[model samples]
Target: MNRWFMTLLASLGLLLIVSGCSTKKDEAPKDPKAAAYDFSNEKSFVVYGEGIAPVHTVSPAQAIVLAKRAAITDGYRQLGEKLYGVKINSSETVKDAMIRDSRITAQVNALIKDAAITDATFKDGLYSIRMEITMSARRWHELFSY
Candidate 1:
């Protein structure tokens, strides 16, 4: 009887230790490549854009595809806004002008011939995209010279 009781106690202790040392399943996995890029340099610019597609008559795969396409287009628009700059009439605040009359905002006419897509992600039914734009000295001179 004494030996049986000792064995039971040892088994309980072992179970306790094993359960306590287990890692949490709910913890988010870390991405090693997320921090690989440095955007502090003034020579380069980074922009992010996101798009959400409503679940309508389309299947899940189709929805995701549409969302990704929208995200890429939105990213390009954001990059164009950053590069060409948005013009608003002085008579009204930019926000008000945008809300009341979108025509007040100058359209981007300059061509963004090249843009690098840094990252693309989909989570919680929304698609997000990141873009990086680098302007060389010659490109800047060409843009201004025209």
Candidate 2:
């Protein structure tokens, strides 16, 4: 019927217009607040330090201090620390420990803008350096929501 053909033609024309309009792509807003770092292959570190310092802002200086502090906390307290078999008063080389600590910290800084660290002093003969990925609370929470 003529009416049926007209109806079909009109529907096809409408669909074509709608499809053409959708071809225009939307762009993302530009803002540093929207800036982000991908941490899929991000390095991580586990350290043994005294305590975490509350820094107002994060920087390389803060990272270094935090790394060193984490490398030598809790001389002999937790059962985990005692299990390492490292003698607390023994003559192990502090220089060696510092070197290992630095290596681990470097890896951590490579991951997050604001590093998260925990202190663990184990009793192992050689000073232990553990690495873990850190995320700031703001960044961490923001990542998921976005």
Candidate 3:
């Protein structure tokens, strides 16, 4: 009995030591290509847009087609908005200082090139599209006016 107890205690001690040493060391994350890029300005980003199916479509296929077209246009608009910005115009006509009428309008105008539709889906009368665009340093500078 004495010898068995000593062997069991030894086995438990070895297990504890192995488990304690297996803990991860405190170290910074390892980046394989940390110093590869000196000046990287090329990037790609994605945008998403959704459109509701029109009520007056001639057929189900036509509904999906129209919704997909609208979704694609919306995606381009969103991408333009992200790259540039939305222009807003607001007016308030206060007749006799009584706040009679107010109106607000927003618009975005941009020419997007080479934007690819990455994914598109139509479900439950709603169509959505994911568009991606890649901009190199030259394109970036041109758009940013730098």
Among these predictions, the greatest TM-score belongs to 3
Q: Work out the TM-score per prediction.
A: 0.55, 0.21, 0.69
RMSD of 2: 16.9
Comparison by TM-score, 1 against 2, better one:
1
Model 1, global lDDT: 0.73
Q: Write the per-residue lDDT of candidate 2 for residues 61-137, one digit (tens) a residue.
A: 67545644555333222222322233333232357446323212111111123333343333422233343344454
Winner of 2 and 3 under TM-score:
3
Two-way lDDT contest, 1 vs 3, winner: 3
Which regions of candidate 2 deviate over 4 angstroms? Answer: 27-67, 71-146
| Residue 72 displacement in candidate 2 (angstroms) | 9.0
For 19-138, candidate 3 gives per-residue lDDT tens digits of 999877665336644423322567687999898899997899898988988999899999989987899999999888698899999999888899999888889999999999997756
Global local distance difference test of model 3: 0.85
Residue 10 of model 1 has an lDDT of 100
- Cα error of candidate 2 at position 99, Å: 47
lDDT of 1 by residue, 1-146 (tens): 99999999999999999998896865644664432232333356688878897779368888888888888888887777877877655444357446543334456644676678889999998999888878665556457544
Residue range with the least summed lDDT across 10 consecutive positions in model 3: 32-41
Instruction: List lDDT for all candidates, in order.
Output: 0.73, 0.43, 0.85
